[model samples]
Target: MTVDESDAYVLRDELPDPETFAHLREVAGMGPRSLEAIERGLPNTIYGVIAVHEPSGEVIGMGRLVGDGGAVYQISDMAVHPDHQGKGLGTGIMDRLEAHLEAEAPAGAYVNLVADVDDFYERFGYEPVRPGSKGMHRRIE
Candidate 1:
């Protein structure tokens, strides 16, 4: 992030623990995720970025890269706690994740994210692959 955050947060290149991950996701308005899923899926993250509140050492923001390491990569769980929104933690999280892909991903690696917010990912070089190709999903029973 271009904004200075050194005083309040320490950005870490690691995923948060399962409980913290679930809580952060819910408080950030992404809604609650199953602990079962969090535990199962977090281990698969190829790379993750975390923002820790220095005063409390809480994980306030995060983003992760998940997919087969060679060709497919998706930016998932991009969120910042509502109280911490304006400090650029979201962008900082993305910055670290993007840097990881740049250094580690292959020549033709595909990076994508489901942007729930408008225009946020475009600055990071993402465009919609919609209308012609829809993004589909199904919840496991």
Candidate 2:
């Protein structure tokens, strides 16, 4: 899917080039788990999208949906370069991601994400998992 923004940005699902992925990692302050997952090819299950600055051919923003591809999908690693944060790039990326999920994920699949910003994701139909539901994690030490 291609999403063209009025600002001359374009969104495409072509797996990000390595340099772009590295830029995304740096912008997001991603930790070892993210590094490992990205490096070990584990996030290959990822559905990745990038916001490109057409004139420069630079990736200014990115996000990914990762899961088993059938039942559970989580939006993760969403980021926009600090220089580009206020211009709606993040929202554009999510718009594309949500559209993909709506069209492709199987019926009854639970789409989930951990949001660093409270109100931003609500606009996209994501709500916190109910209070008692656990969000678990294990990190390599």
Candidate 3:
């Protein structure tokens, strides 16, 4: 299926839909609770644009911005399906997310993303937090 820009709307709508939650899990290598977290937190978060294929209506790429609106916003769960990689879909999602953050986020709003690829997010203007600072997480078990 061709990745049409217009199909972005379909992705946006599907981001919160439970039907596509499984697809998200596969892409992110996460479990059902991850999907639950997304569903639970989606209302309080700011999700940016998503891009999908038109013909099969599959969710090919997705990214989202989370955190408090004014003080902090984080880019999270950016993923493109395996079959859809190397075609700039991830970049397209980031472009949309950045554009949204740029236009909407207040000054001093800290935007962050935990990137799997070392250099990829740098191209979109993300950098390591600091020398001493580090990313922390806790998993429920």
Candidate 4:
């Protein structure tokens, strides 16, 4: 999608529709998700934002926060459509999520995410896990 000078991008506090959300993930080289899972999971987001291309009404980007409401929080599912990458949409998504965390996260809440690009997240003040503290995960088979 060619973003013309006149094309307006709007960021709204809402989850992308499942089709657009899944498509963005697929095109962005992420895994696909079932419609049923999308339907069930989106409404549980503590906060989320979707960037829409005004001219085409396309969901070009998205970011979401998830985890226990009080003690733990995580920023996840941050993705922008390949065509829309480098247009500041990723920063916009992170800006919104960071704002939410700043305003709402409890004082002692532990926030974290696994970064594919350390530099991108480092700018936002997410540092490497401290020495002797390893991040681990197990994928569902």
Q: Compare the candidates by lDDT and give the number of the best one.
A: 1
Residue-level lDDT of model 4, residues 1-141, one tens digit each, is: 785854578899988888887888888888778888888888888999999888888888998999987899999888898887788989999999999999999898999998866579988988888695899998655
Candidate number of the best TM-score: 1
By TM-score: ranked, best first: 1, 4, 2, 3
Q: Model 4: runs farther than 4 Å from truth? A: 1-7
Badly placed stretches (over 4 Å) of model 1 are 1-7
Clash count for candidate 4 is 0
Q: Write the per-residue lDDT of candidate 1 for residues 1-141, one digit (tens) a residue.
A: 575444488899999999989988888778678999999999999999999999778889989999999999999999888988888888899889889999999999988788889978899899998876888888777
Q: Write the per-residue lDDT of candidate 3 for residues 1-141, one digit (tens) a residue.
A: 786774442445225354465576576664455656656765665765566777777776677788887899888777777776777787878887888888889998988877777689999877887775888878887
RMSD of each: 3.0, 4.3, 3.7, 2.8
Q: Which tens-of-lDDT digit does each residue in 1-141 have in candidate 2?
A: 775553577888855655667777687765424544566553464577888888777888888888889999989878887876788888988988888998899899989887867689998877767695887787666
Determine which window of 10 residues in candidate 1 has minimal summed lDDT.
1-10
Which of 2 and 3 is the better model by lDDT? 2
Better of 1 and 2 by lDDT: 1
RMSD (Cα, Å) of candidate 2? 4.3
Query: What does the lDDT read for residue 31 in candidate 4?
Result: 73
Task: Please report, in order, the local distance difference test score of every candidate based on alpha carbons.
Answer: 0.88, 0.77, 0.71, 0.86
